[model samples]
Every structure is written in C-alpha cells, then in structure tokens.
Target: MSYRFVTPIPKRAATGSVAAVYSASARELGALFAPHLSPAPDLHAALWAVLRESMLAGTAPRARKEAVAAAVAVVNRCPFCVDAHAAMLHATGSHDTADAITRGEAPDPLVAWARSTRSAAPDPWPFPAAHVPEYVGTALANHFINRMVDALRPGSLLPGGVLRAPSRRAAGLALARTVRRTITPGESLALLEPGAGPAPAWAGDGPVATAWPAFERAARAGGALLGPTARAAVLEAVAGWRGEHPELGGWPGSVLGAVPEDERPGARLALLAALAPYRLTESAVAAWRSSVGPRGDAELVRVLGFGAFTAVSRLADRVAVVA
Candidate 1:
C-alpha cells in the first residue's frame, strides 16, 4: 500500500523533459504517480512520446479509444487506470457510459468488443473490421501498462468517485490536451538495440506484425534510456535470469538470469520486468529506488513497463499463432 516501494526522485533530481511531465502529472494525477515517472527519465520520453501519439494517432475517436482503455483497465483490475481512462471517456461526453463502467454497470459496445478478444471462440466483431489494428494495439498496450501498474507500484490519483466526477473528468481532458502537445512519436522503430529480441515468430505476418516493428522499437528504446551504469546492471540481471521461476505469468524459462553483482536495483527491476512481475514486492521496489542505485524513475518505469509490455503482448502473438 505504501508508495515507498519505489522511491520518487526529487524534482531537482529528475532529468530534463521527464521533470516537465512529472510536474504535469502531479498537477493532474496528484503526486501519487510521480515515482513511476521519475526513475527512468530517458525511457519516459521515448516510450511515452510514441504511445501518446498512438493514442490519437489513427482515426480512432476519443470515445472508442477511451472505451478500449477503460475495458483493458477493468480486465486487468487496475483501479487507477480504470478511473483515469473512464474520466477521459466521460470528458468526451460518454458520462453515463464511464460512470456505469467504473461502478460495474451497463457495459458499452466497445467494452464487449474488448472482452471478446479474450474469447477462445470469437464472434463476428461488431465494430469496423478495418480498425482492428488500432483497437487491438491500444488494448494490448494497456495490457502491458496495466500489468506494470498493478505489479510494480501502488496508489492512484483519487480515493473513489472523485476520479470519475464530472469536474475531475474535465480536468483529465484538460490535462490530456496539455500533455498531448509535449509528446512526439520519436524514432521508436529504427533498428534493434543490442540486447533486444526481434519480434517473435508468434506475432506472424499480419496487421499486428506490420505494426509490431514500431512497438518493438518503442519497447526496446526504453532500455536505451537507462544510463550506462544502470543499463549495464539491468542487462546483467536479465542475462543472468535462469527463467526457472514463474511469477505473475511465466516467461521463456530458457532465457534469463544474465546480470552480475553490484546488486543494482535496475538489474533486479529488469529481471522482474523480463521474467516475473507478480514477484515484485515493496522491498524490491525500495531497493531499486535506493539512493545508491539507479538515478532516475522514468528510465526504470520504461524498462519495467517494456518488460511487462512484451510479456503481456506475447499472449496476443501466441493466440495469433494458434488461430
């Protein structure tokens, strides 16, 4: 329950643009979400820039976009994410919809569609079949982000209905308006980094795979944000990963446990990101945030988020392969 699990960097200590977003997030979501943003400054900028752009990137309306996001949050049972996106949905004038959703009431069409993706036997999807890539991408992205939130951190912006309130929802819209200008889809998909694995075979040669390059770049780019020291530590931990233990959901057991001593918090964080998120504990969070360890929070979040992102998205890939 304690935010102390991950230590927040002081405003002065937070790096360049990450400091800017931290200030904005504090203004919008309260100080609660700061720790998630402050550690991995570089990753914060690169990953989010592309993701935020993607949120409004294609023709997806804010309504459908937020609906997909809210549904994903509900599916993941991430209280914070559900409220945040539901508010965004409300601000778009889907008041009854958002309110009902957060309270666990009338389900939206998009919500049903989002749920259908999980079905072993999917029905004819009712929405625009052409929007599949964008819709599925948003849902999958939230799948990754949700796991990271539920796993690595704690706390939300508001206590309860406050987050879903009309005024609060308007504020969320305002924040989105402001925050949107700051984000830029960076060169997320340039070329593979040293330690990054290419898009897995399960992704297949389909719409998701076509777009997979960008996501893969964005996912791997966050790891690049880690400073030389922290980056090395994390890579070491991932390399040392024995992959024997299965936590949250297990990852490829044959590939992990590659880090060394120095006990760099980033290394532990990376290992958890790659292999076991359910294994994340307050003690582990605190150790990474330790003064002696890595310097930034955004970098940490990006690396950790990317790890969870890759893990969760693997479900879609495997499902695609089966189909």
Candidate 2:
C-alpha cells in the first residue's frame, strides 16, 4: 500500500537525522511513517522531535495528549489523524473516552479544552499549570500535522482505509505496549539545532518549550519557497484570522486577488492549508504544481507544512496557561 502523494525515500536510503527519527517513530507507530516529510530531513526531524517530546515523552499522561491530538485532528477534519490518535487513545486504556471522542463527544474537561484550542478563546487550560507545555504542545503539533496530512495525503493511516472498530482495536493492541513505555524527555532535542528559536512563554520551561520552537523554525523555512508577494499574502491572511472556519466560497480567492497572477496558486494553497485545509482539492495542488514548474515534491511539502505551522503557531500563541 502506497502512502504519499509524492515519491518517498526507501527506508533503506534514509540517512542521518531522517534515519534516526524514522527508527524512533517506527518503534511506536510500527512503520516508517511520514515518508513525504522525509525528503526535507531537517523539517522531518524537527517535526518528530516536537511530536515525540510533547506527545510521547511527557509527565502528563499520554492518554490526555492523545485525546488532544485526536481533537485537533477532528477540528482539521483529518480522518487519517483522527483514526491514528483515537486508536492511541484507546491503547492507553481510555476506551470509553476514546469512544466518546470518536463519537464527537467531549468526555472530559481536557478533551473539551483540546477541542477548543482552535477557537479565539479556548477554554482555560484544563490541567495544572505545569502541564501546559505537554497538553498545548500536543495540540499544536497535531494542528501542524493534520494540515500536512489533509493537503498531502487525505486518507486513513490504516491499510485500505479499513477503519472499522475491529481494525482500530487491533491497531490499538499493536501499539499498546509501546504506548506504555517511558520515553526520556529531551532526547529528541539532539536532532534540532541549538537556539533555533525562542520557546513560547505559555510553554513554561520544559522539553516541549524547546522542541516546539525548533520545529517552527524548521517548518517556517519552507516559506522561502514562496516569492515575497506570495509569502506576505499568506502571513497577512493568517494574521487576520479569528478561528472561524472559512466560508468555503469565494473567501480565499477573494483574498488572493491583489497577489500577482503567477503567485496566486502558491498563496491560495497556503491560505487553504492554514485556514481550511479540508477545502484543499486536487485542482488546488495541480495549480500550484503547474505554476511552480517541475520543482520536486519536497518543496511542495515544505510550503504546505509552512502554512500549516503558521496557523498552529498563531493558535498556540493564544493558548493561555490558566491555573
């Protein structure tokens, strides 16, 4: 079964940080997942580092973080991420919570807060102040990843899209042992450059604080693929957003009118990725690919990843660590 919109590096060909992250991720997810992001090794490493530190390696219960990941994926309308995370949530023995969440019910305050993180005013951080980094960081990471999955590969992480409960439970069972393993914090930080960027104040002092900024730095590097006009257009649009779902009509197109004709495709694609990734379509990708000529898939992944993280950062900035 194929997994990406573009060609992926054969696992054997992965080297350096990419190889290391893939090996680490496979221990939990059971395969060399995220092949599309592998083409840009730094971005892949940074993303995995953030995800590992925040989701898989924190003092906060991994179940709560998995709930956050699943909620965030639901907000983005990413079925693929929802399935993956919900299964992990189940693996953590929160079967009732997992079932409630998959049914679109918020089973607890943490789950409710996770669902609200994309709003202009998210519910007061539901956990202790100390947990802000882990909880919020997990949400931000999924916010970034859900968009990448939506734009690049919009389907089940499971084989043949078999999302039945039996399959989901089987997956949960496969991951149960690894889900309970203790991962040391900050181990993934070795993959990041020192002082790549400042951690968010809301993150407090923790490995998540360190990892989130580094991932942002690596992901934002993709914005360089856009021309000045196109890049500015994406930033401006994202800045003005207020957590509302875009009106899938003429909205993004209306905003891109002032951008240069040649730059619209990239700008449009970026805007959709940041604000309404569910609206992204094949034609939208085709337009960007055609305008940019024969650039490789890594460039495209970078641009979309940049747009995704831009929104993730914007929303994450608004999250307050209420005691």
Candidate 3:
C-alpha cells in the first residue's frame, strides 16, 4: 500500500504507432485488476479484460456513444457523466447537438419516448409483468440508452435513416455497463485499492498532474465523466483520501495541490505518480493516460473528485446521484 514512482519514456512521434504505448499500458492495467480477477478466476477478470479491450477499440463512432452516454447520465442524475458525455458529443460535431441533448430536446417521436423513459416517467399503458417486468422502467431507460449507444456503430445512424449493424465494441460497452452496475461502489473500491494485493507500480507524477487539469477543462466544457459505477469508484477514492487528509476537501484545485510539487515527476508523469500510491505499474499508468488522452485524463480526475464528494454526500443522507 506504499507509494513508489516510475519514470516515463516519451511516446514515439508517429501518432499511428500507438501500439507500443497501448500494449505497455494494458499490461499495467491487467496488474491493477489482478486481485479482482483472482477470486472469480474466470468471470470477473475475463469480463473486465474484454470490456477494457472494447473501450480501447473505439468500436463505434465517438459521437453516438457520447449521445447515449449523456442521455443515460442525465436520467441517472449523474452530472459528472452527463457533462463528460456531452463534451464527447460536442467533439464529434456541433455545439447545438450537445446543447439540445443537455436541455432534453428530442429530435423525433422515438427520441421523445426515449427521453421520457430515461427520465423514468410512467408508461402510457399497463402490460403483463412477463412483458414488462417490475424493473420495466429501468429496463426501458436502458433500452433507449442502448439504442443510442448502438447508433454509434458505423452506418447505424444515417441522415436518411439507414441502420448499420452494431459493432462488437458497442455491444461490449453496453454489456460492461450492465455488469458494472451489478458491482456496488464499496466492492469496486475494494478491488481498486492498493492493499488488495501487489499491483503495478505508479508511473510517475507527470501524468497525474497533466490529467487533473485535463479532466477539469473537459467537465467545465461539457459537465461530467464516467458512468455510475466508475463514477462511484472515483468518489470512493476521493473520500478515502480526504478521510486520511482532512485539509484536501475540495476537488481539482485542492486535491491537485495536495500532492507536493517536489514529489511530482512532471505533468507528463503526473498520472503515473498519482496512481503510484495505488501500486499501479509504470506501463499500466501510462496506458490509462494514453486511453484517456490528455483531456480525458484531466476530466477523469475531476470526475473522481466529484465522485468522492458524492460518496460523502450519500453518507450524510444527501442525494445519492448528482444532477
């Protein structure tokens, strides 16, 4: 559970040559998730790896995924996720689309119903339990969300109404979301924490610091990041940090400042350093950073901070999910 720092080598100039970075990163991540993998030996670890791979593959166009993710985040009352997804949606095209989504505008009748279901409004008519289970509301919301997510696949969403088949990655992320929902915040935190067992060493300070600001900018630009389960894990980490160090209460600014500059390697190594304490290896931390991109790294940190506050809020009997 102690911290150690690792140095980072600048990635090759060729943007296309992401293989080296990705491979190195995946190795480290694999180590971080090792403990969780140990108990189930088959189910948990296998599924986790598969999901991680799917995320890396970018199976669907970023825009579609963002749209659905944003919708789900909104309905779930998770501001962090909403903001993050909205940013992603904006990145793909126009600010107008992002704005409309955040404001709850539906482009068509189907979309309207989708929005309503996402908000958990009652169905227009009653149906048999077999057709609509007790959790019909949640299931409907998820279905609509899945539809949006599925639209991410190439040709799935076209101007004139062409429906392209869904990619494996799109299907995978949806499946991952479902599985992730089954895991409670406490359980995930336990899996991610350092004491669970030996994990990859921390990469360095550069990535951590670099990522913090990036996440902040992304959240400010859009709103939130990470789905419910991942968001909860972030909050749990932040709360744990605060409980041990009361002075670092707020997120981004306060939390970023908590780590001594001298102890930090550099902005490029910040993420590695930040994760080092958690026993992540250099390669693993690097991969996480690479997967997030500079902006993603920053946004993730901000989300994590918000997540921590969320956990605290819940403990105090406040709202469980932030709107």
The top-ranked prediction according to TM-score is 2
Ranking by TM-score: 2, 1, 3
Compared with the true structure, what per-residue lDDT tens digits does model 3 show for residues 194-230? 2222211110122222222222232222114333333
The TM-score between candidate 1 and the true structure equals: 0.59
lDDT of 3 at 68: 47
RMSD of 3: 16.8
**TM-score on alpha carbons, each prediction:** 0.59, 0.93, 0.26
lDDT by residue (tens digit), candidate 2, 1-323: 36445677777888888888888888855566577788788888888887888788878898889988998888777888888887887788888887788778888898898888888888887788777778877888888888887777777766543345556677888889988888888888888888877777866788877777778888898898888899998998888888888995798988888899999888887888898877788788888899989988788788888888889878876775444
Alpha carbon deviation, residue 303, candidate 2 (Å): 0.8
The CA lDDT at 7 in model 1 is 61
lDDT for model 3: 0.30
User: Which lDDT value does model 3 have at 37?
Assistant: 15
Q: Please give, for residues 1-323, the per-residue lDDT of candidate 1 as tens digits.
A: 34434566666777665566556445433332335544655444433433443454555575777777777676556776786777677667677777777666537566776654444433344456455555666766666666666665644645554434655477566655433333222233232123333444433333334345555665666665444555655454444433233444433222323433344455556556654555666676676567345555555566676665545444454333332
Question: Model 2: runs farther than 4 Å from truth?
Answer: 158-163, 321-323
